[model samples]
Target: MMTFSPQLEQKFAKMLTAYPEGKKRSAVVPMLIYAQDEVGSITPELIDEVARRCEVTPLQVDEVVGYYSMLHRKPMGKFHVQVCTNISCLLVGGMELYEHACKKLGISHKQVTADGQISLEEVECMGACSWAPAVEINYDFHHHVTPEKLDQLIDGLRKAQ
Candidate 1:
């Protein structure tokens, strides 16, 4: 009942090659990322399966998932909007941007919209210091975002979806 396939096993094997010998533990994160990509969402069962495939404990796998906000443990909405609220972004009104997105969607940070189309989150950073107060929607980077732009983006995404 591991819910794994040969294709998944092959992917795990290939990703494991990126790490050094007898250091499969170092490959845990990548493997979990692969698992997450394959399933879209990480379940307790999926974590356990990744742990078995990577020869690590379930706790170890779960720990990695919990440590990273980029890693999704539960199912997210159609769009996952992660706003950077760290120091660099904060100085550029990242906090206000997050608040605006929440108010616009009527869902607080980390909460999915009622229609399951949007999920808002406050992340540490998005590595676009030049474009501080940025947001990543469905992994697409939107830099130097303003409240008006946020509304436009949400509207466009809703229409597209």
Candidate 2:
């Protein structure tokens, strides 16, 4: 049987009421976000609960979650670092930058560091060709990045925490 904690139930109830009855599907995205936020990653159980509460099929929730890169199906570090490796960035040494990040963080793409502080991901153009070799940490973009600059940024983030 699907079960949700009182808090989750309340939140889901509120989410349901936020939309009209027939448009409960509109809550899919927000529900996924809430589940991810609550559990740090979306699980099958959470998806099932979301589907049950939102009155949608599990496949519908799965489709939406899978379509978005921001929704992590598995565990990820507190900070997610996505490096752009598209055509423009590749021309300007994006590959080298990605390598440098892996070496510095001591983890491969789609892997989280041992310290659990950061996870690395490779993505297509971040729509910043003018500033090729850019990386997004969480949501902020660091553009026109060099190895040295990236090192500094990483250090700054570590220091900030």
TM-score of each: 0.84, 0.79
Model number with the top lDDT? 2
Candidate 1, lDDT over the whole model: 0.83
Cα lDDT tens digits for candidate 1, 41-119: 8889888877776788999888888887668877778888888889988998999998898899999877898888788
Candidate 2 structure lDDT: 0.85
Tens digit of lDDT per residue, candidate 2, span 90-116? 999999999999999999888998788
| Model 2 misplaced regions, further than 4 Å | 1-21
RMSD, candidate 2, Å: 3.4
Tell me how many clashing residue pairs each candidate has.
Answer: 0, 0
* lDDT values, one for every candidate: 0.83, 0.85
